[model samples]
Target: MRISACCFKFLAIIFWICPTAIAVAQSNDAQRHVIVISIDGFASYLVDDPKVPLPTIRRLAREGCVVEGGMTVSDPSVTWPNHTTLVTGMKPGRHGVLANGVLVRGGIGVPVKIDSHRDHSDLVRVPTVADVAHAAGLRTAEVNWPCTRNSKSFDDQFPDVPNALDYTTPRLRQELVKKKLLRDETHASFRNSSIVGLDYVWTEAACHLIRERKPHLMLIHLLNNDATHHKRGAQSQAGYTANAYADMCVSRIIDAIDDAGIREHSTIILVADHGFTVTPKAIRPNVLLREAGLLTVENGQLTQAQVHVVPEGGIGLVYCTNPLKASEQAAEFKKLLTGQEGVADVLLPDRFDEVGFPHPRDYRQVPDAVLVAKDGYAVSGTVTGETLVTTFEEARTSYGSHGFLAKLPKMKAMCILSGAGIRPGTQLQDVHNTAIAPTIATLLGLKYPDADGKPLLNALRTSADAE
Candidate 1:
């Protein structure tokens, strides 16, 4: 009974291989670890923002490949859809998460902002890279990544694991508590606490996992930067602080890998969900509808509404009462929105497919028409008598916002990759969001058979070798 050479070598690191042909292949490959860090609201332009010294981010750029043109976020350019797209290699249209929330049957639904603890895995129609990696015998971990609640793709999960926002693993919590990094009041009230405090707790938890569990594939989403930028403009003092804080968080995770003796064996990928733009003007198209008696607000309830403007920052979806008469309503909507101030482009149903939007026939919440705000203008969710156009200083304004058309240069997301088997100091252009999952999956020697993205080969060691 002679055992094969490959089988003997696999037995040496038996823990890494779960079992299967692909797992065997991955175990044979040099790639071992992947730690994906998603910094929400990070724009490609920030890679050179001279305002502050983003030491960690700059280090990554200096040492690894930077996707120069930027990673194009999914349409609507919101959080959850793009995050899901990052892992699944599918657009929001293909992945069934067309937006943060779906507008259903002429009624708007709450966004799936935070993943529910229930088995909502079916919400995503496609399999994530984690699922593929897990199937290939790799342990996966997710910390506060959207659409990952109760997901079977991961073996070790925090935040999503216990239906809690903080990584409340009993031991992990206690360790931070003893270290004076966490207190009961702070941990218990994290949901209502400052963005910095919540992120501090989460970052420590990620470090704990990396130092202890050492998952083969780990994804960490930091929300402080997004929250801060939304409150203060992207170039504001607070925005700089939030981004610097995110950089530090990444540094800690990298340190954890080094402390765990897996630095050389691990691969680190940095990406942002979407970019940011300072929205100086607010447009409330619904205000006009209310004035025209097309919509009614009785005690703040939408009672009689013919059109509902579902505001998504720089973009708005005008939903008609009759999806059956969408064609007719679209024509009216185009004229109605075109006459309104701060409206950049009124995209009708015919342009949905052109802009990579989910066709009306494919989505449950596809709107009659899309309204794009002009540069320096953003849409608001106000359906009442708010002004049609008002300065951000005068209105209840966001210092910054996203969810704009991806064609806008300022809306482009960022991607920085540096790790083992990657071409250091490489700069790739025209990188899209769909290409990410496939590259990560392929690096681990796993097959991303369903991926729509092409593997970014120019940044890889193989590509460098060919060169």
Candidate 2:
């Protein structure tokens, strides 16, 4: 039977549009975007704490999966290393970022320092989730994300470093300057800006990227809360204010996604590098080292040293510059470090692997031993000071600090995954920050087989079905 003219025309139109519509739908599905917001010192406990006014974070937690106990950060719970773990799904040992900065070995007679002015390639040994996604033709952005300086993987990069303005992607920096989101383009202006002001600037940068580019994978980091906590201690009134501001920043990001018309298609993961611990005492292990003749200081300068302890918040990395001497006086060093005030225990190099750190024998950045600070104590790098231990009041004032053993409950980081393919109100017992990257990789329809973490299958729609 011959079709009527009107029906024929209608059928023709349907046939012609069908393929294009199908392709559009497929493209939309493939265009899933992920926004990861890291509140630097957001403790898991604070998510439920009635005192910390984080309505936005709490709402997200209510809508998404919340790690019950808390997410365990990498060993020596610190910012850069844990942030790297969140994106790489690997610990410090594998990722090759042992500290907040690159740990430089100063050899036998020199003191070591963590050089923060380093490039991404100079620190990270493994590919991040952003790198993997970008390699697979997905657009990526990073705003104030650590260890991402000069990362070619990101389509837009605004790094978190001393001279952050100098390293930002040229186009993005110009755009930001033109918009006055960044008032001045100079690194000095950025450095002089207050922590709270910089936090707002960083959030504005992230919001701009979301509205303008809608990157497939975007990582945003806000730092005011961490700085505030470091100054006034966690749960302090000042910390509450900073945290509230960070929550507002998160709200702004969500708004930007909605404005970009990709709210429904986007996934937001709220995380933290590590939790904070209020320390009243500061332990100066270097003083003990000097007294023990393991270290030497002259003319108020550390001109020479056998073993130098670099304090990293609640933990101290004891570097034995002379490996042979370290072996010879291992027992003596242990005796001196062990049972000291504010000293919890000394972790020898042999146990480094057990705690997800590279052994000193293999990695020069690895310390000969790790001095674990006890609760209410923080390690300090004061060799010239007469006292081996002192109260926080004497130094400045009692403040909050992190970089403790990952096993400590106080060192647990925060984790909240929401939107897109996530199951609302889902909860996991205790998660590791390492698992975050693989989960993000799965959400982006990519495989990160080499990652040490497994995706949170129970919290994801497609993966949960597979389970």
Candidate 3:
């Protein structure tokens, strides 16, 4: 009787452990893994350069689909709007991000903080890819992704925000505490002075989250390169170093995923918000238009002009009140701007709109005239010596700027897709920014509503088989 009882107990233990192990293995296989990595300020040149030691990225390109020239919609090409477009798959106008800084009503003295959170509701009109993924029963996570703060999209998010001004002063910790923005216990963990390029820290936090709570879909945005370009310019050694550092961070995350034993089952997509350019001279087209009587100022505010130019610092957008007047203004602005110390080319709004950007509903909000500067020329709003000198000259130390027309050779972003369900060694050209979300949805078998981006069927094995 005793021997029979022991035998029964042994059998029951085996029954319990065996099913648990098998269930875990099955769960790993049944679920799909997706990781979207945004390397801020990444231009196509990095991957194209053999000398750059981006081994993981190189492997992805060689093994996965590579969109050699991923195009951006339009300019200021600044971070917030560009990043918003990537996940939302909508143009700036549709999504309403508009610029890094939106003009406040009542001319509020300070610029509204435009970090990954929509402090004002209903600003972001569309659903993010993560939103679609979650609705389909997939888990989601984001790290340092812009405009993610207080976002309703992600299941788990570590939104990026500008380091508070007090962060630089002695009262940093106290201010963070008083505002209830961070806990005192977190002070030691987040005590870095230069928060801009803290890719390693961001990745560390992400890795911990991945291990502690395995998310099916994850989005990570690394900004070392962007910061380096903003401070050192795009072509400088600092920018190169920043790129290499970002690549290293990417490698680390890949290793983390591998260690978690999800390498083969996971798909990794690497992309950039926009490319960068270096500007040497700063041009203020509004001042010139003001002088030309094409623009007028009343009560310290700018009013209607035949051609209105808004300085994005590096590139200027021109809005024409009269479409007929555009040609005339273009001719005159061309004569007035070209080769005049800092000017590059004057682009008409009609030609500018051809990049597939819809016209702004509020014409008063967009520039009637647009200006492209030479590699070193930047635009400004300050007046000095007849020419409006926004900053005497564009900052020389920074190596990066973007927001020029996508047609420019230097303005192309990069895209790499690799993983279990993806077709290997596929090279796609002419992929638009809008197609990213749909592609992600197709991979996970999720329903993405109102997505502007179409899935490239050729890039996915499952998609091809389904077709």
Candidate 4:
């Protein structure tokens, strides 16, 4: 058989172009790798601090892009809400995760309780970064990420919730147990495990996932730093030790990525849910509500109440239980809370949006009003205590807290992006926590136009620029 010159040329071109096109496709897949790490209560101010021994975090910041003033987290700067916002790129109002737990209202005069035992579907209303990535045919994993209970978005998940062990992926759990990284598959075992020990296990699990699953998008959260900051102040010696340990954990994850032979292609982003403040004084708002005849207590138990105030660390969510006298009750409650010591500013329903909160009419999780605590003070839900305020020495439990207004400088969270496609040595100004999801979506070449945030274009290197 005789091959014509034109056919031979076409065949040669096809063979030459196919390999180059395949290599390009492989490179694109490699560049799509992204891993998000959330160190709970890791304040951005500590990033450059000499006292805080965060060598790994510091190295990443130097080698990659770092937000100068830190990432300003969403209002009611708590764990679940902020973390949900991190992945969903939506505020509590939009994402529907208003608290660390879901607020359950039990009719009129009954104090609302935060139920932390809810599933991800009930808590997060919007699609997360994991969901979008998975829908786009990318493998995703979540390790100890809050509000991820029973989430089907990720290929692998170890949710951060009560009874976490019960909800962990069975195959991964068995593997971890067999490796002695996890104890028994009981909630009691998980509960009894030390915070530091859990941190270690979560990191190890993430490392294992990276090496084995090689997920395109992985979310990891560590809780030891947050626990330490709550027990001891953020600047306390114990907190420093916790930070150092977290840095080591980050180093381990990096090593795992390297061991997986994906270090060149993998991008790691470090972020935090919220920062911490040393709250030496605790203000019991429920006591004030009681004294004002808004609520009645019997036998140290809340019996009947016209209104209820749920203390969320640095802020109080004031709820008017009686809809009949809602306005009257709200006005009176505001009057009582206005001049109280340790109370900063009271935000009425109208001002909720200013703080990135949804109106109660829009979302049931929202309270009638918000009570902001003064600096160095925290709102307490203690109603039985006779004293309206408790000093640090008296309370003993008063050490640190978050859940403060997002605008506060103390609530600034950390944001560090490193590795593939990230612009090295880039310094960004203060970024919104919501921007994270969009940035991650951009990194993976996925579309998330509904996100309230815009991608951090300055921190990302374009293909043309890379070339």
Candidate 5:
């Protein structure tokens, strides 16, 4: 969720420097290395121009297959939900990661704290590609990937470093302050939530494992760009500078592979969890509900409520604590919100089934009502704001936002593949995020028919077929 910024700040260290390298032992195994580096908010525009240069990622797009048509990601398009989609090969509804945070089951008359506490595995209901790969005896590793913090499937995991329990802050800070690259760097704009230092943290971990342990399947999540794009629209000068940093991080890992003597034998897949858009307007659904008298606030707290909303970026989950009355409540919402400015779509729980969501639902997280915003607007949870409209002048400085349904024109995510089992210099069309896992599973020599995604074989050279 938005936790990536605030949560990582506490573990702040300079990110400009690269970690010292340890002596690497040569690998004896014949297995291929699949290195996945996810740039959190990367989009196709970053590499579309042939004349413009994006050194590291551009090579990836040219040498590997670029999804020219754009890849459609999971619904709600938040980080965890979409990242979960990649490993599990399922959509949000089927995967059970309905939103960034789960809705509390019986906590209706209470102020909704949707994002406060969460565990990676708490929301996932199925086996991941890594789990299947691990079961097949292939070595797997994960670094800083969300929804994977607790997974036992990886042979080596730095699932959530810096912010998670594993990172010892003082020692890390000292090591970072000593590094040449990061020692001089400063994040003056905390508005974007600096991953400047943490980027090096994950990169070093992944690189070290690549040189030494050599896991067959490695997932490295690098996310500084996500924040910059969040506060600064993709077209902003700030976003470009941030993307350059993220690109350099990728180069480090790529260099690590070459140093491991496995460059030719490795496949480097670059992707993003989702795309972003600029929204200058805000829709405060909770404010509207409060004004409607459905939500009651007292003593600067939520004392009682009939209708409540958990605002995601461009989408919001409207919850009714009583399961029985959910339908009745949703019908009323359609009338109140549908024609309202900036409101595009409002859905009832029963319609969840049609969109690959679980409706007749299970557990505490299902939304009784769902809200989607028109382009240039975002759904905010700020209950104190004006009921219907609020101009977000803050974004005027560096404007961008995401979390609408993925099918919308601007929400397309990134997918680029190169190296082993992949054909070079190709362009792909109609790629879906769901297709990634099964194809990767096939490459890892593993099977996951249970996954909703199919292998995207068009991007593959004959080498993939031989594998």
Candidate 6:
């Protein structure tokens, strides 16, 4: 009888220890490494279509939590602002990155660098997910993320000088060398492409970082898709090719992670800063606004007289010189600009006020009135006469553009979450761009300060017992 009782006690202790051991293992397993990939011009329209030939992306969607329509925030929907929004989960208005270039006030141009290292102190307001992740004692790494030159967000960054005109092959190294932009050359590996070689280099650097550093939080931005779209338009074959190349790069990254034995313990997020649209024509709103005596241009410099028509589209950004005369000028301009071609939506400053946007005093980073152009219709340059009325045949240069309203289905970005704690094959609808930061925070069990996005509980697995 004594021997039998001892045996029973020993069995009970074994059962208790077994469950505790499993729990500890599970907790360790949940400490996953997150890899975030942002393809500059990736669109859901391309991802959802099987004809696009993206096998890896399709597989990721199948194996992860895929948000079919991840909405973006607002327009002129350039790269810098949109990329800022993706990590910070804030709109351009909130983040103070209203556009790719800084707003020129009184003929004094505000300096803007694509590299965050060069930004003014007053610009970056919010802490990004990378910052929050680092705060939580997680390792973070970034490669060629936009607005990184003068930024203090990432623990590791490969900064690139921001120059729209410096896209040539020979100029690539010169920009890096002269600017002293990049942190480590080992993180920079060039991949040959028909268009841009540096884009592949950025991807290779990201792969190297993942293999070497194995950061808990990683953000990689690939720009070739956006570059190709800029040159070939959104609907062109070159755009598709660029998208495929980006997909291939993603596959290589995934393979690298898998080979490192971190595949199952890693959560991969694929996002695009914004979608792209083709510009078929250019409409010069400033021409009409200047004609109405609302604007003054002398010696190639524009001065605000009574009102300013700033282009949120390609060409004009209107600013009101005299606040009291805004209504009268706006009324006149509205009358004259009605039925204008290429005009998508017009928002007055008062409308912005109604929407709880910061007052012009606070939101002065942007223009007084924003004019969004319809698909294929962009704003014209400040050049005189004939340039203003150029048809799509003449002005339809860029293969793709974004920065319209985020409410449009076409403008929506994508969000995919996969790995430990995430429910496989889960589909989330109506996910906002604001929700991303919070989701990432929750996955890492970190607290994000003042983040607007919520943790996606639906994407998480139920308790182990339930599973």
Mind giving the per-residue lDDT tens digits that candidate 6 earns over 1-467? Answer: 11232343354345333433212121333457878888877766777755577888878888878886664544446677777766766666665666664554553222211223245233445556665665445677777676655455455666443442132123333444344433323332222233356676667666766776677888888888878876777557777788788889999899879767777778888888777677666776656656765556777555445555544444345565555564566556656666677666666666764322444555445565656567776665452444345664454335356655665566777667776667879898887666777777766766554555677779877687255
Strongest candidate by lDDT: 4
- The residue-by-residue lDDT of candidate 1 on 103-166, one tens digit each, is 4563432221222343434456656788778877677787777777656667666543333535
lDDT of 6 at 213: 64
CA shift of 251, model 5, Å: 0.8
Off by over 4 Å in 3: 1-30, 69-76, 105-117, 120-122, 163-192, 195-197, 286-310, 317-352, 355-357, 362-369, 384-399, 463-467
Candidate 6: stretches off by over 4 Å: 1-30, 73-76, 107-117, 160-195, 293-316, 321-332, 353-356, 386-389, 464-466
lDDT of 4 by residue, 89-203 (tens): 9887777788888998778888788999989877877667777677666888999999999987788899999899899999999989888887777778877879999999999
How far does residue 323 in candidate 1 sit from its true spot (Å)? 2.3
How well does candidate 1 match the true structure in TM-score terms?
A: 0.87
Local distance difference test, candidate 2: 0.83
Ranking by lDDT: 4, 2, 1, 5, 3, 6
Best by TM-score: 4
Off by over 4 Å in 4: 1-31, 393-397
**Inter-residue clash pairs, candidate 5:** 15-197, 16-181, 16-182, 17-182
| Superior candidate under lDDT, 2 versus 3 | 2
Candidate 2, superposed: residue stretches over 4 Å from native: 1-29, 393-398, 463-467
Worst 10 residues of 3 by lDDT: 105-114
TM-score against native, each model:
0.87, 0.92, 0.74, 0.92, 0.85, 0.79
Q: Report the poorest 10 consecutive residues by lDDT, candidate 4.
A: 19-28
For residues 109-164, could you state the per-residue lDDT of candidate 3 as single tens digits? 21112233243123444556665666555677887776655555466666655432
TM-score of 2: 0.92
Candidate 5: which stretches are off by over 4 Å?
Answer: 1-28, 49-53, 167-193, 299-303, 393-398, 463-467
